[model samples]
Target: MIGEGVAVRIIPCLDVRGGRVVKGVKFRDHVDMGDILERAAAYRDQGADELVFYDITASPEGRSVDVAWVERVAEAIDIPFTVAGGIRDVARARAVLHAGADKISVNSPALARPDLVAELADAFGSQCVVIGIDSIRENGRYRLRANTGDPDNMTDPDLDTRAWVERVQALGAGEIVLNCMDADGVRSGYDIDQLADVRGICDVPLIASGGAGTPEHFLDVFRRADVDGALAATVFHSGQIEIPDLKRWLGEQGVRTRTGSVAS
Candidate 1:
């Protein structure tokens, strides 16, 4: 059961490609937003509980994350942040952490080798290992897809979504970022039913990503799915929803959230 006093975190996601923040619908047609450091600092001051940075092209291009940018972001923001993309081994994960990232997220590589989760957890403790699962609903069933949900990487026909979540938890993952590919940038609302299903099997903190368009959406996900955090990229990046205001709205509706400036 989720703790009653744990505040629901509001997180901003920055999807970077070639070192610039980008936003797109369902992981296609990405448009550059702005300088990564500028956006990171803006969100931190806006009261975001944490930030998520993903090098959108790293997995597809077959390379590791650029530690240089991670270091810059670490210097720019005082809040905790997670770095993802092409983090496949313990050594690479160590480098990112040493570069000042609070956590490292693994997706495509973890799908190919499940033991990597165990190895990371063993080396850095479960708290530092975050498993990012990009899922799509297919014919009434949720299926796992990787490589940022590219069709070419959708070759795992038998990978069950629920099973994968359960397996990762057993492997010692401390958190799960469930990115609903179908809802990636639509911003209608979160895939509540899907989040609830994943929430059922997830033991660690669950972060809901995709389809967050309004303050109500965040409230719904928290009340319906019992998620520990809500993450958004398009809404936050475009300034459609400000973190401080969103947190204030959630608070007005009786949701527990961190108020005022994020602690340095």
Candidate 2:
């Protein structure tokens, strides 16, 4: 169960490819959404608790996130935000943070070199480091995959999902964002069973990503898995769900969310 009185954060995720916000089913066949800065500012004004910006191609292309946009986003929104993709070392992480991100998320690079997690945590504090895990269920057990679960780049690290969660925490990760590959952009609902398994082992904040289709889905994850936050991309980007309305509805269901004025 989630700690009592812990307010659940509602976050909107922006997956950037070629500097445009994009959404894809199962992390492929992405379609452009809109300009990044416009979307970021809109979500902030909509009362989003936080925002997540992912440069989806950075790792696959062997480059770091463009810090120019990071600086622009920081100047655009008042809410805290996280930047992920291709952040492999302390220097790259520092550049992202210095550009105004409240947190830096590491996925593929951390999988390649696990020590990078401790290195960033040592230099910037654990609270500034977030580990993004892309996972899929295979043979009734969870497995970790690298490269944002892109099929061509998919390589099983041969690490159990639960065990990896424990390892990252030991390495000083302050939070974990678990992206269920099977559930990514499917919109049926969050992977409750997967999330519950992680919550059982994760001591730090756990943000549930992938498979958020409706406001009810958010309610279900918070009520069932006890995650610290629920993150959605397609729903928010496609106007299927709005943050203020979602937060208001969740609060009505007895989920403690940070109160904000709902757009009339």
For residues 1-264, write the lDDT of model 2, one tens digit per residue. 257667889989898887888877656898889899899888978888999999888998789899998998899778899999989999999999999999999988998999999999999999999999999999999999888635677777888899999999999999999998888868999999999999999999999998999888899999999999999888888888978889889889999988756354
lDDT of 1 at 58: 84
lDDT of 1 at 144: 88
Best-fitting candidate, measured by lDDT? 2
Candidate lDDT values, in order: 0.89, 0.90
Tens-place lDDT digits, model 1, residues 134-198: 89999899998877635455555368789999999999999999999788778899999999999
RMSD of each candidate relative to the true structure: 2.3, 2.5
**Clashing residue pairs found in predicted model 2:** none
TM-scores for all candidates: the values are 0.94, 0.95
| Clash totals, every prediction | 0, 0
